[model samples]
Target: MAGKKEDEQQKQLEFEQDEVLTVLARSGDASAFNELVRRHRLKAFTWASRISKDPHLSEDIVQEALIRAFLNLNSLAHNHRFLGWFKSIVRNQALMKMRRGGLYRRELPATALQTASMHQASVQVDDINSIMDYLIARSSQAENDGTSKDPQVLLERREWYGIIRAFLRVLTPREKSIFESFFFQECSPQEIAQLFQISVGNVYKIISRSRQKVQEERLSFLIRAQIRQRREDGLLKQNVLDPVSLKESGGSLLTGTEQLYRFVKARHPQLSLSYVDGMLLGAFLLNIEKSSVDMSSTNMIDRNYLITNGMLNLGMRVRYVEAFDFEPPDPNLTTEGIALAQGSVDLGMPAMVWELIHSEFGLIYGYDDMKQQFYGLDTQSDEMVPYEQLGRLQTRSLFVLGFVGDHPISPSDSLWRWCQMISRHARGQDQTFSGFVNGLAAYDTWMDVIRQRAIEPLGHAYTINVLRQSRKHAMICLAELVSEWGEVKSESEINQTIFNLLNKAEEQYAIVHDRYVELALLFPVPSGGEPNEPANAARAIELIKHIKYAEQLGIEWIEQIAERLEEHASRAHVPAIVENPPRAYIM
Candidate 1:
C-alpha cells in the first residue's frame, strides 16, 4: 500500500512539470497534451487579445494556434524550450489573422483606435457606428497627408482617440449619443435636434459643452506625450565622448582623470594634457590599504573628494554627487545618482562616474532610455550598462562628477595651487579611510609588505605598473611646467628662480620615472613576474627606495617653487593664492 502511494505521488509531480508534460505530449499521450492546453490556455488567450484587440477573434486565433502546436509537437526536440515554442505559434497565428483581415500595422492592429469603443459595453451600438464613420474620415485625411505611413503620427492619433473615448465615458448616455452623432456621424444641428426631439439651440449647446470637455482631456494627453518624448530624446541622443584608450592606465581614478582632462581641454583649448595632469597631481596621488590582501590597495583612497579638489585647483567649477551604502545599495539613492549623471550628460559634459562597467572609475558618455542602458568606457571595454545596475554592481556605490565651467586663473596661480595639493598629498593629508596609508607614507607601507614576502604578486605588480605610469606622467608634467614658464621672457629674478626650480624638479621626476619603469619590468602585471623570489624582491626594493628618494626631491623642489611664487606675489602686491577659492559642491 505504501509503494502504491509513492508511485501516485511521483506521477502527480511529473504531471506538474512542464518538461515532463511536453515530452509525454510529444510521445502522443493525449491526456498529457490536454493538461498542457489547460495550463497555458488563458495566457495564450491574453496574448492574442492584446494582439487582435477583439476577444472573440482572439479566442478563435488561440484555439487555431493550439491545434497547430499540438500537430507539430513531435517536431519540437527540446522539452524545456516547449513553452517558448508554443508562444511563438500563438504570436504567429495572431499576426497572420491580423494580416488576413487587412488590419496589421507595425506590430499592432490597424483597427486599434476603434477596438476599445466598439467592444466596450458602455459604448452604445449606434455610438460604435458613429465612431467608425469618424475613423473613416480621419483615415482618408491621414492617407492624403501621407501620415498613414508614419508610426509616430499614427500613435498620436490613437492617443487622441483614446482620450476622446474616455471623456465620453464620463458623460450621461443620452449626452454621449447626441455628441457622437454631431461630432462623429457629422449630423447637422437641425438634423440632430429632429432626431433627438430637442431644439436646435439645445443641440448646439450640448455640442459646445461636450467639445470643451474632450478638449481639456486632449490637451492633457498632448502635454504628457510631449514631455515623455523630450525625455526620451534627451536619453537616446548618442553623446559619446571621444574615446580615450585605457591600455596602460592602472588606477581607475587616473583613467577617469584622463577622460575628464579631455573634457576640460575641449572647453579651454590652450590647456595641455600634461598641464592638467600636473594641476590635478594625478601622478602624485596614492593610497595603500595596509590590511587589504589584494591589488585594490592601489586604488584605495577618498576618491571623490580628491577628484573635486584636483578640479578646483584647475579653476573649474565642479560638483560631486555620490551615494554609498553597504551591500544591497539603496534604490532611492541609485535613482538620484542616475538622474544627476544624466543631467550632466545632457549638459554636454561626459560624467566622471564610479563602477560603471565594473568596480572601477569610468565615464558615462551616453545613455539609451528606451533600452534602459548607459554607454560607458572602462578598462574592460566600451560597455552598455543597464541603468538599474549602475549602483548595484560590486562596489554598491555611486559617484559622479560634473565639470561645469572654467573660473580662469593665471598660469602662476594655477601652478601655485598644484604645489599646495602636491604638498598635502606628499604629507598624507588626503588619507581619510582607516586601515590605509596614503601619499609619502604609502611607499613605506608598500616596501614593508615586500620585505615580509607577503606580497600578492599580481596585486603588487599591478601597483608597480600603476605607480610607474603615474611617475611617467609626472615627468612629462614637470617638463611642461618648465617649458611653459621658461617662455615667459621675464627679467625678474623670481621668474628665473621659479624656472630653475621647475627644471630641477623635472630632472628628479625623470629619475623617479626611470626607477619605476625598471620596477614595472622586474614585476610585470597579470603574472606578477616572480616578485617573491629573493633576488627579484631585493631588486624591487632597491628600485622602490630610489623611486621614493627621487619623488621626495621632486616634492621639495615644488615646495621651493611655491615659496618663490609667494615671495613674488608679495613683492608685486598680489595674493599668492585665492583666499576664498571656489568650493566644490557636493550633492
Candidate 2:
C-alpha cells in the first residue's frame, strides 16, 4: 500500500511538470505566462546585467523584455523553437541598445572560449591575471596566432567585471533605465523609446552618451593606475601634475584643436580621408561668426541684396546658420559636435574627407571654404585644395553613405538655399553639376534629417519633427502603393514623394517661424509681441480648409500653445471648425 502511494505521488509530480510546459507552449494561459517569465527571469536578468553593467537596469530590462515578449507573442507562430527565438530577440535588443549609445566592444566568439581551455595548463604557469592583460594582448593580436586558446583567459577577463559592476553608482534613474535596456534587458533603442514614449534619437543620445560616461570611468581608472605605478616606481611628485594644471595646460582629446593638415591627413589617414576634408571645411564654414544677427533691422529690401548688400552674402549664411541654429556646438568649427556627427560616418571619415577634396564633386566644398573662414578672417594664402587633386588619390575610405547611408550635412538656412540653387543649376545642364549637388544634398539631408533627428537637438527640434513626420508619411504612402502580396512595378511615385518631402523638410520650420525668433532675441523685450498662435493657427485653418484641411495637416498638435488661445475657446466643447472671427480678436 505504501509503495502504491509513492508511485501515485511521483505520477502527480510528473503531471504537474507536463502541465507547466504545455501551458507555457500555449497562449491565453496567464499562469503559464507568469511561470515562463519566472523561469527565464534570471537568465534574461544576467544577460542584461552584463551588458548594461547596472543591476536595477537589469531588472528593468528583464521586466520590459518579458512584457514585450508577452505583447508580441502573436508574431511567434511556432512554440518548439521559442527559447532560441526569444534568446535571439534578447540579443538583438541588447545590441540595438548598445548601437544607440555608441558603446562598441569587440565581439567575443565561441572560438575565443574554446581556445581558452586548450591552453589552460601552460597559460596557468605564466601567472596570467587581470582582464587588461587578456584584452590588451589578445585585442590587437587576435588575427595571426589564435592565442586565445586558454580557459584561464576567462579568469583574466574578470577585470572588466568590476569596472562594469561599478557602473551602478553613476547612472541617474532614467539613464539607469536606458543602460538596462542596452546592457541588460537587451531591448533595441526603438523598442525602448517606444516603450517609454520618446524619440529614437533621444533614446540613442541618452544611451550612447551614458556608455561614454561609464567608459570615461574606465579611462580614469587607466589614468590613476598609471599615476600610482609611476609613484610607486619613484617618478615625480603628484603635486606637479594636479587636475587643475592638467586641465589648464592641455586640451581634452575629445575637444578639437587645429592640427597640421599633413599630420591629420597622414597619420590618422582614416580621419584624414579625402571625404573628411570637405566635411571639415563644411563644418568650419558652418561655425564661423555671422556678420549680422538682426534681420529685422538690417535692410533686405531687394532679393539680390543678400549678395549686393553686405547683409545677403554667402558669408552671412555661414555665420547665421552657425551661431543661432547649430545644436552640435561646433565651437570653433571643429567642435565635439562635428566629431560626433563625423564619427558616425561609415566606410570611414577618411574616405569622406577624400570626396570633399574635389571641385566638380560638389564644389560646394570650394564654395563654402572660399566664402567662410575662421572668425571671418582671411588666410595668408587662398591655399584652397583643388577639386581635381582629389580624383588622382584614393578617395577617403568613409563608407557611411556607401552601405546604409552617407555622412550628414549640417542644415541651417544656408543648406536649404544651397541645395535649391544647386538643383536649379542642374535643371538644363549636360554637366554632372546636379548629380554632384544631389549627392552633397543627399549627404547634408541625411546629416540634417537622420543625425540630428536622433537627438532632435533644441534649435532644430521643431524642424526635425516636421521632417520626420513627413518621412513617415512618405513611408506610409509607399506602403499604400504596394498590394497585399507584392511591390509596385515602379516606385517612381514613391521616390518622387520622398524627394519632395526631403526638399520641403529643410525649409518648413524656418519659414513658419521665419524672422520671428530672430526678432524675439534681438531687442531683449521683457514681454514678447503676441505669440504666432492666433495668427498661425488662423493661417493653419485657412490652409486646412483650402484643401482636405484636416487630412493635409498631419503633425501632432502641441498643447503648449494654449489651445490656440482664441481658437481654444471656440473649440472647447465642440469639435467644429466654424470660422469665428471673435477667436481671431484675442486682444
Candidate 3:
C-alpha cells in the first residue's frame, strides 16, 4: 500500500514538471527551449540515428525535428503528450528524407500499419554488433581460405562500419534514442531514471530495446552480404556481370575514379552518372539524416575523390550517384532511413515501389555508419529472370487467360493496353496496368543496364537465359496464331497470322478475364502482415500474381509453337546460331 502511494506521488510530480517545461518552452523562453533540447536531444539523436543510420546525418535530423517542433509549438494539443509530438516530428522528418531520396522504392505491401510494424520489428530484433561481427568473421574466413584477395576481404571488413551506420538509421526515433543512449552514451539506468524522473527499471527497458537495434543492424549486413557474395561467386548461376566494370585491373586494381568511370561507360554506353554526384547526394542525405555526429567533412583530404567519382552521364541523361550509392527508404520511413526530405515533387519522385523488397525489411531515411545498414543500395546488379518468365504456375496461368481469347488465334490486347497506358497513369483505375512497371523494374539491375540494353542489342549479353527470355513472348504470341489458324510457311502468312492473333486474343482475354476475375485476388494481402509472408518462409513463396497469369497463357502458346521449332532445330549450327544469331527477332 505504501509503495503504491509512492508510485502515484512520483507520477504526479513528473506530470507537474512536464507541465512546467511545456509552459516555459511555449512562452518564447529561449533558455527553456534550450534546456528542453538539452534534455531530449540524445533521445532525439538516437531516434534520428536509428532512422537515418549516419551519425552526422542523424544529428542533423535531430536538430531539424527539434526546430520544427519548436516553431510549431502553438499547435501542441496536450502538454503531457510532448514526447509523442516530438516523436511525430522525427517520424515525419525521416519519412520525408526517404521519399525525397528514392532510397526506398517500395516492396510488396500488406495492410498498412500491420505491414509497417512487422517490417519495423524485423529491423529492431536483429543485433547490430552481432551482425557486424558476423560480417567481419565472414571476411576473415574468406581471407584465410584465399577464396578472395585480401583487398576484397578488407573492403568488406571496412564496410562493416558502413553497414552499422546504415542500420542505425532504420530504427524508429524512440528505438533509436534508446539504442543510442544504451550503446553510445553509456547512460546507466540510475542516471537515466534521475534524469527523466522515472523509475530506474523503465530506463533499463529502454536500454534493452536500444541494444536490440544494434543486433538487427549486424544481422542485416551479414544477410545482404551473403546474398551479394553468392551471386558474385557464381552460386546463383546467372549472368556473370552487367558488363559495367573495370577490366580486372592487373597490378594496382582500378582505384582511379576516372578509370572506373571510363570502364563502366565503355561497357554500358548509354548509362551515365559520376562518383562525385553520388557523394554529393550522399552528403545531402547524411546531413539531413543527422542522428548524432557533426556533418562537416572539413578534415577529409582528396576532395577530388568525391568530385571525380560523383556523377555519370549516358547520352542525354545526367545521373548523379555514388559508387555504391544507397537510395533513401519509401515515403514511410523505416527505423534506419533518411531523417528529412527536401526535393521537387513534380517527378512523382517520392512515389512508393510497393512491390519490390521482401516484407521483413523496413524503409529508412538516412545513414548509420556504425550500424552498417542502409535504407537501400543504389545499384543491385542482376540478370533479372526475364519479365515473361518470372511467375509461378498460377501467375503464368492468369497471364495466359489475359492474352488468349475466344477465337483461338486471337492475341490478348489487354496486355498491350496495360503496357501502353500504365507508363503514364498516376492513380485509381489508371494503376491497373501496374504490372508493366513491375516488369520494367524487375529487370534485376540499375538504370545503367537499361542504357546498355538500348545501345547494344540485347543479343550482346552473354547469358543464355537472357537470350531465351527475350524471345519467349514473341514465340508465345506466334504459338497462339498457329493454334487458331494452322501452320504458315511464308512471311505474309506470318504477318496475317500475327494480325489475326492480336485481333482475336483481345476477345479471348475478355471472356476469360470475366470468368476468372479472382486473378487479382492473388495480389491482395492481409493487413499489418509482411506483404511477402510466403517469401519469408523457408520455401519459395507464390509468384508475383501477374507473372503467374502470364505463365498459364504462355504454356499453351509454347505447346503450339514448339511444333514449328523442330524444323529449325535440325539446322546444323545451333551453337553458332546461339553465338552469332542473325538479327532475326528485332527485324
Structural similarity to truth (TM-score) of each candidate: 0.53, 0.22, 0.22
Point to the candidate with the largest TM-score: 1
lDDT of 3 by residue, 288-307 (tens): 00111111211111222222
Please tell me which predicted candidate would have the highest lDDT against the true structure.
Answer: 1
Residue 530's lDDT in candidate 2: 29
* lDDT (Cα, tens digit) per residue for candidate 2, span 173-237: 88878776655444788999898899999998998777656544443344344445545776432
| Candidate 2, superposed: residue stretches over 4 Å from native | 1-105, 110-112, 117-217, 224-536, 539-587
Candidate 2 TM-score over all chains jointly = 0.22
Please, what are the lDDT tens digits per residue for candidate 1 over residues 365-422? Answer: 7776556577777666788887666666785666677666666667777777778778
Predictions: Cα RMSD each: 21.9, 24.9, 25.5
Q: Which ten contiguous residues of candidate 1 have the minimum total lDDT?
A: 578-587
Sorted by lDDT (best first), the order is 1, 3, 2
Clashing pairs in 1: none
User: Which regions of candidate 3 are displaced past 4 Å?
Assistant: 1-67, 72-88, 92-213, 216-587
